[model samples]
Target: MIDHLRDMGLGVDPVCRVLDLSPSTYFARKTRPKSARRLRDEELIPLVTAMWEDSGRTYGARRITRALVRSGRQVARCTVERLMRELGIEGVIRGQRRRTTIPEPAAPRPPGLVNRRFSAERPNQLWLADLTYIRTWTGRVYVAFVLDAYSRRIVG
Candidate 1:
C-alpha cells in the first residue's frame, strides 16, 4: 500500500495517516539503514556460489569456507552455510547397505566336510569351504572357495 501511494507521488506521511499508522513508524522503516553484516552477506553470497560450483558442487559449506579462506577470501563458516541454503545447494548423502546373501535349500550339502577335525595328516586330506558376499560398482557378488587344512592350499 505504501508503494502504491508512492507510485502516485504521495509522501509516506500522508500514506501512513490514511492507513491508520503513525508517520514516525512508517518513516523509520522506510529510512532504516542496512547493517554491515547484512551487506557483507549479500556481497559474499555470489562468491560462495562461485566457489561451490567450482568445486563441482561436491563440497559442503565447511569445505567451501576453507577453500575460500585458502584462496585469500576471508568469510565465516556460518556465512557459507547461509549462502548455500539460500542457493539451494547441498552435499551428497550416502545410501545405506543392502543385504545380498540368499541361502539355498538344495545346494547339495557336502557332508561334515571338516568333521570338526581341522587337522590333516597330509596336504589335501581335509578341505573346508565357505561362501561370502562382496560389493562392487556393478552390484553385489557372491564368492565361494575351498581350502586344504594341511597345506593351506585353496583347493577350489
Candidate 2:
C-alpha cells in the first residue's frame, strides 16, 4: 500500500499522515524481511488443498495436518485450519440422527410420567421408553424399548 501511494509522488510523511501511520513503522515494515513461517504457509496452502480433494473433501484440518506430516511435510494443525478458512474450503461434518419413526400428526402423546424425572424409588415405580433404529445387512430395523428406572433393566 505504501509503495503504491509513494509511486504516485505522495511523499512518505504525507502518505503516513493521510493513512494515520507512523513514519518509523512504515520504514520498519519496508526494511523488514518476509517471515519464513508466512512463506511456508503460502507454499503449504496448495498442497493442503490437494490433499483435501484427495480425501474427497471430507478431511478436516486435523486429518489434513496428519496427511501432510505423513507425506514428509511439517505443518501445524492450526496453520492448516487458518488456510482452510481463507480458502473457504471445509470438510463435511457428519453425525447420526434418527430418520425413521415419523410420528403421525393425529397421534396422542401420553401424559408426563414421573414428571420427566428418570430416577425411581422402586423397580416398577417408573419406566422409560425410547424408539430407535438399527441397520443390518438385510435392511433397517426399528426398535422400541422399555426400561425400569430403579433397576435400570429392560422391563419389556
Candidate 3:
C-alpha cells in the first residue's frame, strides 16, 4: 500500500496522514533495515540457543555466560539474559524439598542401653540394632542392622 501510494506521487507522510497513521510510524517502517548491530545480535542468538540446549536447559544466564567464556567466547550475563529472553528461553526452577523423617508412636521402641552416649570402652562391649524401611516397587521393605559400636562393624 505504501509502495502503491508512493508510485502515485503521494509522499509517505501524506499517504500515512490519509490512512490515519502517525508520521513517526510511517518513517519508522521506511528507515528500519537489518542494521549491523541487529545482524550481530541475530547471529549470536543461535549460539546462545545452542548453548542453552547443550546444557540440558538447566543453566541460568550466569552459568551460560560462564560456559561461553570457558569455550573462548566472552559474553556478559546481561547479554545472555537478553538473548535468552529474545529467544523465548527460560531457566528451570527447582522446588523446595522437605525432610521425610517421621516418628512412629505405634512401633516398639528399644531401650537406650548406652544412654545416648555411643562410646564403648572395648570391642563387642556394646551393640546397637535399628530397623529402617526402603521403598521398592513391591512396597516398603524392612531392613534390620546389628552393629558393634566399639569396632564400628556390622555384626549382623
- My TM-score estimates for the predictions, one after another, are 0.47, 0.52, 0.44
Arrange candidates, best TM-score first: 2, 1, 3
**Predicted structure 3, TM vs. truth:** 0.44
Q: List the residue pairs that clash in candidate 1.
A: none
Give candidate 1 regions above 4 Å deviation. 1-23, 95-156
Clashing pairs in 3: none
Model 1 C-alpha lDDT per residue in residues 1-156, reported as the tens digit of each score: 797889999988788887899988877877899889879888888788887788787889888889889989888898888888888997655666676656799798767745688888998777888788788888778999899989887889
In model 2, where do residues sit more than 4 Å from their true spots?
95-156
lDDT of 3 at 72: 88
* Per-residue error (Å), model 3, residue 129: 47
Error of 2 at 84 (Å): 1.6
What's the lDDT for candidate 1? Answer: 0.83
lDDT score of model 2? 0.90
Using alpha carbons, what is the TM-score of model 1?
Answer: 0.47
